[model samples]
Target: MKKHQATAFLLLLLAALVCFFAGREFLTMHEEEAVYPSPHLTIKKRLSDYFPGLKNSPGDSSVYIFEGQKMGGTLLILGGTHPNEPAGFITAVLLVENLEVTQGKVIIVPRANNSGFMHSDPQEGNPQRYSLSTPGGPRWFRYGSRLTNPIHQWPDSVLYVNPAGQKLSGTESRNLNRSYPGRKHGKLTEKIAYAIMQVIDNEKADLAVDLHEAAPEYPVINAIVFHENSAELAAVTLMTLQMEGVDIRLEASPPNLRGLSHREWGDFAKTRAVLLETANTSHGRLKGRPSATLIINGKDKNYMKAAQLGLLFVPFDEDGISLKQRVSRHLASLRALVSGLHELHPDLCIQLDNLPNPIEVQKVGIGPYLTPSK
Candidate 1:
């Protein structure tokens, strides 16, 4: 072979090798993360059970049911609405693996936007996975994109109009949180939202909580945002959390916000809807580097400096807010909300037990509570 022809052939072979490995890494993200449900889990269903259109789709996710022998009210907890938020997703995993319901039912959707879990946001330099040292071994979870994977629904519009008649940036059309009370024939993200609404309506849920996390600089950090119908419950929850030294604030869901879970779930399904927010430094733009350590340990020199400048919404210092603390905050808030609901309506009281204490979780960390993978 001629020298130039041989060189060209070698270069093509090298490119092919690179593409092969890169493609494998990319496809690994599509594999669902392992979550060992607690022995108390009664049944596991798919999102398609509610909305059949979602069957065999990337958006289809697992729904875990923990039903008690005695009949009572039902509660729905949604996690991973934005897959980039690790604490939200981890907390749901914790509940599924540890919680025991004794007098009511608890339904948890750990990956509400399943499609979003299949990819990381472009240009963010975020880690694709982070691991925790569990007693069984190391448990890894994906750190994915905030929006639905474009591969599932492509070609963004210049401007997207929601079912509520509200206009948003075209990119937000793929945000699961912004597609609530979704259209049956809408986009992939919208169909997932619709399926959640179906769960609320068909199950006759008395309460629904959507778990989320925000950048530490966001003003709504460590907050409980509830629909108008849940104002009293939220206020009580805030007070209870404060009394327990949790320092959570309460925000009422704005009526004009069209597609949010708190607004749409309450308005359409008649279920008391609330959303919880925790502070996550890993997700903030001000963080120094994007690494698995940042997502798990959450220590960053830049964030500490920003805190000193009064630029952050939550307190930060040499000891950064670790994943344990963030997950503990979410757990504490959930406990308070459940207690408040029981107080407000005796008939709708949902009793639970065998939950890990928030303080203990913060102290010992999440690794111990997580069940070992078989």
Candidate 2:
């Protein structure tokens, strides 16, 4: 070969080698993260069992069941509906690892949007994974995108119309939250939603709670959005939380907002539905230094500035809102909701024996409650 041609060939080969290695690294990152549940887990299944369409699909996710010896009320918890909110996922996982149901059942879906966990949003510069140190070793969980991976479900229209007849941005079609009461033959996200509905139906759930986090600047932060059917429960929950020193606001689900879990689940299922929101600065647009530390610490200087200018919904200070605080708030609110439900319907009582209270979680941190990695 000519001198210039030989050099060009060598460069091409080197580029190809680099691309091969990079591609392998990217694919390997998609390895599924392991979640070890409490020894009390009675049953474990996949979302596909409810909607067979999701079998072997990226949307297929695990369902962890903890059934008490005696039959009673059933509670379903959804986590990672918006993968950008890490606290929701963490809280759900913590529940699975630590909770021991005594007089009822608890169902946990730690990765509600399972497909979303396979990839991160482009240009978001999000960490691919975050690690938590356990007594045995370090365990890592995927830091996923806010929406479903487009590779699993494609072709967004200009304005996507949901099964609920609500129009949203085309990109929102990939959001699991906007495709509730989903159809079995619909898109991947819709199929996932449909499967969850099936679980609620099959399990005869009494209450369903979806955990989420919003940007610190958003108005809905640190609040519970409950369906009309859950109004009495919401009121009682709010009162109990206040008595426990957790000042949480309760907002009724908007009638016009279609396809949301709080609305659709309540409308379709016999279960009362409530969605909880916590303040997450890392996901805020005003966040700086987008790193795992920012996600865990929940601290952002820009958010502090925004708070000073009265642009934030939640109180943001130099100390910042840590992950522990957000998780504690969610857990506390959930306990209050369950207590309210028990009071209203004595026959459908769910007696949870050991849940780390907010005060102790804030004082001792979440590590103590989480099961050690194996």
* All-Cα superposition RMSD per candidate: 1.2, 1.5
Candidate 1 displacement at residue 124 in angstroms: 1.3
Clashes of each: 0, 0
Q: Please provide TM-scores, in order, for all candidate models, with all chains considered together.
A: 0.97, 0.96
| Worst lDDT 10-window in candidate 1 | 347-356
lDDT tens digits, residue span 317-338, model 1: 9888899999999999889988
State model 1's lDDT.
0.92
lDDT of candidates 1 onward, in order: 0.92, 0.88
**Best-matching candidate per TM-score:** 1
Instruction: State candidate 2's TM-score.
Output: 0.96
Candidate 1: C-alpha RMSD to true structure equals 1.2
